[model samples]
Target: MATVSLLDVGKTFPGLDTPALAGISGSIESGIITGIAGPDGAGKTTLMRLMAGLLRPDSGGLTVLGREPLTAPELRLRVGYMPQKFGLYEDLSVLENLTLHADLRNVTGKERTQTFERLLAFTDLHRFTKRLAGRLSGGMKQKLGLACALLGTPELLLLDEPGVGVDPISRRELWKMVHELADQGIAVVWSTSYLDEAEACDSVFLLSQGSLLFSGKPKDLTSRLRGRCLHLGGVEGRRRQALATLLCQPEVSDGVIQGRNLRIVLKDGAARPDPSALDISGPAEWKEVAPRFEDAFIDLLGGGPGGESALAASMQPRAEIRESLIKAEKLTKSFGDFTATDHVSFEIRQGEIFGLLGPNGAGKSTTFKMMCGLLAPTSGRAEVMGIDLRRSPARARERLGYMAQKFSLYGKLTVRQNLEFFSGVYGLSRTRQRQAVDSMIESFHLKQFLGVTTDDLSLGYKQRLALACAAMHEPDILFLDEPTSGVDPLTRREFWNHINGVVEKGVTVMVTTHFMDEAEYCDRIGLIYQGKLIALAPPDDLKADVASAALPDPTMEDAFIELIHRQEAS
Candidate 1:
């Protein structure tokens, strides 16, 4: 049965020329996960709000559970909606928040008690009921929010990017719980920027710039690219260079580094070109690989930018430095009796991309904060460019650049204003600031958005502006904390391409991310768990350590989960 239906729905916000959602029509049925996916500002949230009856369409019709959601007050009672930022009071205990939501939803008496017990058990959050919501891990908080939303026993559930920032193990657990809910005949509508999640759904609606591009099974879209996907082998150490060259080719539509090889998609019906013809050095082999949902999505979006990073090309190369640019020597941080970072030690050399990966509350962020001089360590030292962070944090920071997980820029400021402000903060002279801002506007393609406020820019453009601000100072070292958290795959590729270009110019990078595939791009990875560094190795070596007879070729995620499980077992 169709739980929600849209008939040529259209929505337009005041003072905006373009409609947020235009002529949208789709059916969300019961007992299955219906995925709504698109890039940033693709009307996903708008459509979801319309279904939840939070906003009424300006044109066309929308029905939820066989009733006009805008006209039916009771429809809200039978529908549960979890927005991207779920409202769970940080100061309240998990149990208290649940009780509050139950009261608001009018769940009363014995029924409330029964619902609380069932939800706590279902989300595996019973053990932490007394813990404050702010103290819970990213995954735990998500579960708490879900529990609160499910309090009214709604027939339909809406989740917007529920897996964002969640580690793979926790994401897997959440997926299991959601599937179990669907098994109980509840309709699930999951909106996400992760294409892999969309591929897992029973059906998907792909939107772009306020239009419905595709609505069907993910495999049905993936099958359209059969025989077009190929894995270019023998790239090995030169994979990034080869990928850069391959992307410039007219025949290649999309390409990315996969472990030690380059996975690429040729334009539809385009002849396969030889590696030598594309100017890739040495012997290379091409093997046909299965098409992924991302490939098809990018294809539908008119393919990715088919050239080297323009942002990288505009920057000047850095002077050669043979020593470690960043070093954390026995770093330890503790809040009272709880240790957040326990004796973590690592060194990042010049031009190397070092990754620090861990589950939530696993000490990665603590170690990062200590290294960046944002937090004082209980013991040991953090040295950047041979200068101690504790003794001279300002000097150390002057030589480094940091892009936060949330893109910490003034949202109300315009693009030009943000660039000018960051330039001035970096201590550029008046003339240099003007030069830098002009160069950034041109390189990042922000000229059109110069007058637009940061709050109104698309996520992709916001990311571009953030990178521009971080790199405009031409710092020797860069720190990225979950830099690609909630963006789509295409934007992620673009961001990495720029990072690769900068690394080639002798910029050292220290990054932390939950995306295991992105981990493949790192030179070496340090796995932190329970406030201790558990594993440190190159990406291929890490995967090889966990490879087994049943799983001859383990992925980065597989290695990560296995290593963490092994540590816990020990």
Candidate 2:
């Protein structure tokens, strides 16, 4: 059955002439997971909301489960929607939240109990039922939202970036649960900007500017850019900088930084260079490589599709640490019986970016929170620029900037207003605030939406705004937690450009994220698991260690998987 259908659907908000979904037409089948992929402002959410009957389309036909969704009141009962920013009762316990949802849905007695129990088990939140929803971790909150959405066994499900800001293990679990539900004939229309997850879907629809760009299976979509990727490896310092500058030139479509290596693609489809022909002005090395799904996506979106096999082979790696900025000596945090973090230690050198990596229940959050002074450590200690995090938190924080997992600014205020407010909060004088706000608005390309309420802005804009606010004070140390979550690939790239600029200025960064690929951008990484620093080294070292541990040709993903499995086994 056609679980969801839309024909020439269109919508335009008041005062905006451009339709959010311009003549969009598609059909999502029953029991299938349809991924809606697009960049920021591509109308993925608008389409989902329209399909869920949350908004009336300005024109065209639309139906869910064979009925006109907007007109049929009963359809709401059979459609489960988990919005990007789900509204959960923060003060209520996990079970209380679920019970409230059940009460609202009129689900009662044995059925409710059975359903809740099954969901809790599936989500692995059975032991956290007594915890307040507000106090739950980011991943746990996401699971709670999903559980609430599934309260009534809705036939059709709509999830808007459900896995964004969630830990990798939690994401895998969520996908498993979604597939299990789909196996029972549930239709799921998931909206996401993460191309990898989109590639895993049964079928995908690419949206651009409210228009359909492409719709097909993952293989078909990626098949368009085969044999176009080039893998370059070399030494650090001058060589790394030179390569980055070269790859990010106007001639290159995309450049992925992986430790001492790079995966790059040309902007214009062309023949690959011979390994001997690779231009190596610096001491670093290079090598020809195969194309990846991300490479194909960038190629298709930016230039014509095609590539060559000839490429350069790279040499050995050499790294040089400039100066130590932030150092942690056995940093630890505990919540009574729960040891959230234990004896974790690391250092961030000046002008270098460091990444904190781990699975869902890892000690990353606790460690980050402790470093940022959001939580008191149970034991151990940390320092930022030699200032103690415990002894002189305020002094240390004066030189720090933080962008939390879920950043919150005044939603009702305009983007400019929010920027101004944050500037003042960061202790900028009136004149400085004006200059900072104007500079940010211009640089971030937020001028067009300066007067627009932040509430009306899309997820991507919200992230950009949050970043601008964080950068207003230009702190020496920056802490970012999943800053690129839910952002489109293009925007993510742009965001990284800003981050790179910041790092180049001798800023020290400590970031935690679920994007394993992004870990390659860091100069060094610390892998935390079960409140301990399991591994701390350069990205290539970690991967090499994993490969040495018996995984042949281990990529970062493989290393992470092996690391997590080993931890679990022990």
Candidate 3:
């Protein structure tokens, strides 16, 4: 019998026009990893909440472990759930957190000790047992959350976005540990926005607008796009324009930028894209290839069927490349004896895309903060557009823009109000501020949501508003700190499209991200490890440097991990 069975299950919240989940039906079995895949606001989180018996369905019947999920008192003890933000007591040590969880689950004696040892070893958290939870890295906290959830050997595990804010290496490790649990006869259901991660699942459930889109094996979905997907290689320079053109084509189902190459899927009976049709100054190549999970996903969403035409804004003309616009010479920052950044130096040219990457707590963000003048460097010098930040921080800030990782907008304000507030913050005149806010509303498609409170908007709309606020001043340099975290993949593509449009107009961007795949979008990447710059190169070069015959097809994540390992060995 299936571990979970849903029959026409539905849920709706009061005052909401659309149901959060509707007509959802599926069966999840034991001893396998089942992936729940969807875009933002697709009811992925709602389904998770329902499965854990935290919410009652408004319609249909649901059974978990052969008991009615809504009223099963024993289910709580046998199921482990980690919400999007897994709560870890910041003041408690790693060991203390685990102990508290064990106490809650009533685990005692040898069983508790044995579970603790096994979990610490599996999660690589033994050395950090005494360390406070607040000090542990983003990845470590996720692992610790899993360790706490497994205190009583729960039969079914539900993880909702546990990997959302973590680094690639730690994400891989977390997935590896979860697979082992499934191997031991436990059922695992994890939700994610990344299709690449979903493809590896034993079974996948694709959700859209709270309805079931596709379910069953991941391979079955990709099979539908056989002979339709093509990979365009030898692509260089600004990828935004090329990607934008392809996505707008009637024959193209979907397209994305991937490490100097463009991966696309065509509609049935659609002709191949001719290189001559692309607006380019040089040669571009193309070839038919096997479709990835993302290709199939795009197809399922009425891929070639098209979306809001407003999103396909025309690309601005390429900007002239000037001298070094950003310079960091032997930049270093230290907290007491701990060095967060050591002797990091690099230069960013005008209109260039620079990516900063590393594991959690690897000082990548610290370097970004220093360069943005958010935090002062303990030593060394940095400059933006020839202005010395150390001597003139405020003047340096005026020439730049920033989008923080978290939602920085005020929750109490409306959409237009947020834009107006940001414009004022940038010292714009009342007339200019009104004009800027109106322009932002049109550009970001905030027409329909002008009156909605920022907190009440969907995640995708919230992201668009935040971006609009960032670009309201039209600064030359833009700093995005994990700008796309928690957003759906399609939304991420749209966000990049806007970014590409700006870059074409001579705006330089410096970004830090945990998504290894996003590094492909950068013109150059700098990888930091243990407060040191270990690797600096294009994504393709970094991949080639670590790739061997055994792993010729290395991903950005693989290359990143290899670089960190090399640094440690040295």
Candidate 4:
């Protein structure tokens, strides 16, 4: 039986010219997980808000729990929803926040205590009940939000991008828990930009511009592109150039770098030739490969210019320049008796992409903060562009461009106003400020959005604006902390496109990401667990080394989970 039903539903917001949902007709089955997949502005959020009764449809009919969610007071009690930015009181402890949620749900007496115990244990937050929600890392905060949403065992759950910034381990746990909830006869409707997560669902709905483009099982989409995909391997150190070359080919429908190989899908009816004589990389080794969810989506979206635009301004290649730009030695941080970063050390070179990865609350951010000079280490050394961070914090900051996960921007200001303000702060003169703003508008495609209020912009737009402000002065090194958290796959590639362009001009990049696939793009990655750097290696090397014979071709996510398990066991 269906728990929620929609019949030719349509929704439009006031003052908006387009309908957020157009003829979104589908019934959500009880005891099953239904995933909503789409790009940033594809109406996924609007659809979730409608399912949760947070917004009313302007046309047709929609119902939740067999009742009209808008006018029915009791329907809301049975519906649990967590937005992309789930609201959690920063000052409240984890246990306190859970308790408040239970209270609101009217789960009293024995039930409240029993629910708390079960949820704490299930979420692995039982030992951290006293930690302030604000102090929790991005992944920990996501777990707390899930705990609150699961209160009272609601009949239906709606989660909007709940795993955006969560580590792979925690993300897998969430999927496991959600599947278990489905087994208990609770319907789950989840909206996410992560195409990989969509494959884990019983069914998927793909939306674009308010219209449903495809609906059914995830395999239904990927299976269509089976024989069309190929994995091409170039000479070591020339993979990116090969990818750039493939993106310009008419026969290549979509392409991306995976480990040491470039995976591309061919356009239908294109001539298939031997890979040995390709112009970009002659004698290229190639193999027919199965397509993943990401490949299918890119093909559907008409992939072009894989990372950067064909017309993007050129950044002179820095191929010959290889110098250690940032260095850390025995980095350690402690709060009372608890150590956050335990004797961590690493070095990053100019024009290289370095990634820091770990589980939620695993001290990745703590290490990043120390490197960026936002936090002082207990006993460690950090240098940025040859300037000692401890001795010359101000001078070190001038050479670095840092963007936090929760990027800070003026909500009250327009898009251009915020850019102008940051330009001045970065010490750009009037001529320089105007030049920077104009260049940013063109680079970020923000000309039309210049007058739009920053707070009212979409997640994708906000990301572009934040990045533009960070690069106003074009610092030598860029530090990005979960920069692509809530962005869709296409938008993420676009963001990286700009970053890739600048890196060619001798700009160093240090980043932290929860998306395992993104790690494939990095030159090297550091894996930290329980406040200790346990492993450091290239992405493909790490995966191959950690993968067991049983799972010979392990994914980056699989490798991550196994590494953490090994670390904890030791």
Candidate 5:
């Protein structure tokens, strides 16, 4: 058994005014799974890295497995760490990666073989044993990373955002593996953005901007939302519109839109919609609903009622579809005989913020790359702004903005320098470029960091700069791939504000994300599983459809879980 504790911990990055871990304190029990969850900019990664001995706290004591984490050499043998970005050599085969880790950890032949076999079986990676680590899908790579971390069977495991970008099925499988490890008496401390995943932890530490907010079991969090939730479902437009509209209402405190339905927690559940509620076009579909962990989280975060005025967008003017913002028909891509995308078809409407959702390796990136003309498809067509992606790649590319998942900007460049570089590429006139850069500096809060090099900025700040650059071009559509990964909750919220602002300005947005909560923000979503789209609809509709087939009071999370299980069972 291994115990971890942080007592009044604090860490202030050199040259930064604020402390990343401001007098934080938490503990993890031996032989159980512990979770730390928060928005982007939260000190979750900082705290976990502190415990892993990657960074020393500026103040306070940190102990792991009865030793000082920062100075305990013996502790390394008992502690395994999987970073948010696992640095596996892309050129190495899966087996080679495992072998490298085994050698580094000093595992002998028999122990290595046994551990590798069990891990491969547990992660369902047996068939891809010979594949290059880089060739594997995101979820598979994550599992491979975990396998490396578990090679030594350390007493304590520290994983940072381990499930980010993994598919629903892959997430479930990963959790099952984690639970099994804990059942065998390993102490696992995992960080993630998914509240449902957090719920499975034996205990959780909720952090925000370097401060501990809540520490307790999942039930404790849910208990906070008791009697505050209501569920609604009906015709497509009415349901989504109602949910979206309700979110802006003062009486409604936090809501989630799931395919033609709404799950809301009101300040007063007893309060009813006004009798003279504006009659919308769809059927009169409404109901009182049960609350889930997510509802409780939104409520706790002070999400006010989403009433009629709050959702005024239902009455907003509609626009004609601009000629082909993005078009894909029967698009297919395959590696060997395994299809990554098969006959995928969709047209991204102009000024729409479309979302692509799927488990790891579901071909979301492949689809995104195809549209960007970065990768050629095995079959079918991909187009952007009415220009063929393959035939006139550069012509189609000029009308789009893309933000890669990781920092694509040069680390050595100052914030302003990066902006200037991008502005030049966008071909803005000198006057226009100066104006755009100035506006971005103010809007993105990058003024203070104008001269700071990219490598010196925090991940959240770097992410903001990246988004700012992508938007500098003011393209008709923006493609964001897990843009908010590893960011703290507060920063994630701030990021979404910018995204929502862009959408409000009628700029079409296409995004891929690991956070399910973010999925609710999308006008429409495509659920991809194993390289195929399993479901495509508004969030409320997907939830309502699942609810119709579920036992009474099933939640969106439940519906998603059930849907995946049903697919697997069949």
Candidate 6:
């Protein structure tokens, strides 16, 4: 049965020239997960709102559960909608939030008790019932929001990026829970920017710039690129350089580094170029690989921008240094009796990309804050460019650049204004500020958005602007905290291209991310769990440590989950 149907639905927010959703038509079936997949500002949220009856379509028709959502008030009782930012009251306890939502949904008495017990067990949040929602980790908060949404036992559930910032393990758990819901005959409409998640769905509606591009099984789309995908290996130490060269080739449509290999997609009907014809150093061999959903999605989007990063090309090269550029020596932080970061120690060399990865509440952020001089450690030291952050805070910060997890930009400011402001904050002279701003506008392709407020820019452009602000001053080290969170894969690739370009120019980088695929880009990764550093090694070595007879080719995610499980067992 079709749980929701759209007949040429069109929606245009007031004051906008283009429609948020245009002539979109699709059917969301019962007892299956249907993904609404797209890049940022691709009308996913708009379509979700329309289905939830929070917004009415400006043209055409939309029906939810066999009736017009906006016209049928009773349908609300049979539908559950969890928005992108799930509305969990921060100060309230988990149980309190669940009780409040139950009251709102009219789930009363013994039924409410039974529903709460089932949901708590299903979400594995039973132990944290008395904990404040605000203190929950990213994954726990998401589970809490889901528990609240499931209060009424709605037959139709709408989830908007519930797995956005959670670790891979938590994301897998959420996927399993949602699949179980689907097994119970609930129609699940999952809106997401993660193509991997979309690939796991029963069907997908691919949207871009407010129009439906494809609506079908993910495999059907992936099958379109069956013979075009190939993996290039043998450039072990210089994969980034090799990938850069490969992406510049006219025959290559999309390429990314995957654990010592470059997975690439050839342009439509393009023949494989001989390894000798490529300009990259070292011997390379190409092996045909299975096509993934991301390859097809990028190919369908007409491919990404060519290899070179314009931002990197515009920057001045840094003087090479043989010593560590940033170091954390026995760093520890505590709140009363609880330790946030316990004796974390590491050193990042010049031009190296070092990643700090962990589950939520795992102290990576605490350690990151200490290194950035945003938080004071209880013991030990954080030094940048050989200067201790505690004793030489100003000098240390002057040589460091930080892009926060949330991409902190003044939402009310225009793109040009934010650039100019950051330049001045970084101590650029008047003339240098003008030059830097102009260069950033050109390099980041922000000229068209100069007049537009940053709040209105798409998430991809906002990320570009944030990185431009962070790098405009040409600091020696860059600290990125979940820098690619919530963005699509294409945008992530573009962001990493810029990072690689900068690293080539001798700037050290320290980053933290939940996306294990992105972890492959790091030179070495430090795994933090329960406030302690559990593992530290190159990406390939980490994956090899967890490889087994049944799983010979363990991915970064597999390594991450396995290492954590091993630590717990020990």
Best by lDDT: 6
Candidate 1 segments whose C-alpha is farther than 4 A from its true place: none
Q: What clash pairs does model 3 have?
A: none
The deviation in Å at residue 504 for candidate 5 is 4.0
Per residue, candidate 5 scores C-alpha lDDT tens digits across 23-124 of 877788867899988766677888888988888888998889888976778777788999987678889999999899888888877888888888889888
User: In candidate 4, how many Å is residue 33 off?
Assistant: 0.9
Q: After superposition, how far is residue 89 of candidate 1 from its true place, in Å?
A: 2.0
Residue 350's lDDT within candidate 3 is: 88
Q: Highest TM-score, which number?
A: 6
Report lDDT (CA) for all predictions: 0.89, 0.79, 0.86, 0.84, 0.76, 0.90
My TM-score estimates for the predictions, one after another, are: 0.96, 0.87, 0.96, 0.94, 0.83, 0.97
List where candidate 6 sits over 4 angstroms from the true fold: none
lDDT by residue (tens digit), candidate 2, 220-309: 867665555666665445434444465545566677677777666765566543333344544444466766655666676774211210
lDDT of 2 at 490: 74
lDDT of 3 by residue, 419-496 (tens): 888888887877877877777888788999988899999888988888888887878888999988988888887788
Off by over 4 Å in 2: 103-110, 248-250, 272-290, 303-323, 373-376, 408-438, 548-555
Assess candidate 6 and give its lDDT.
0.90
Better of 1 and 5 by TM-score: 1
lDDT of 1 at 512: 95
Could you give candidate 4's per-residue lDDT for residues 35-102 as a string of tens digits? Answer: 99888888998889888888889888898888988988786679888888758898999999998888
Q: What are the runs in model 3 whose C-alpha is more than 4 Å off?
A: 235-238, 304-321
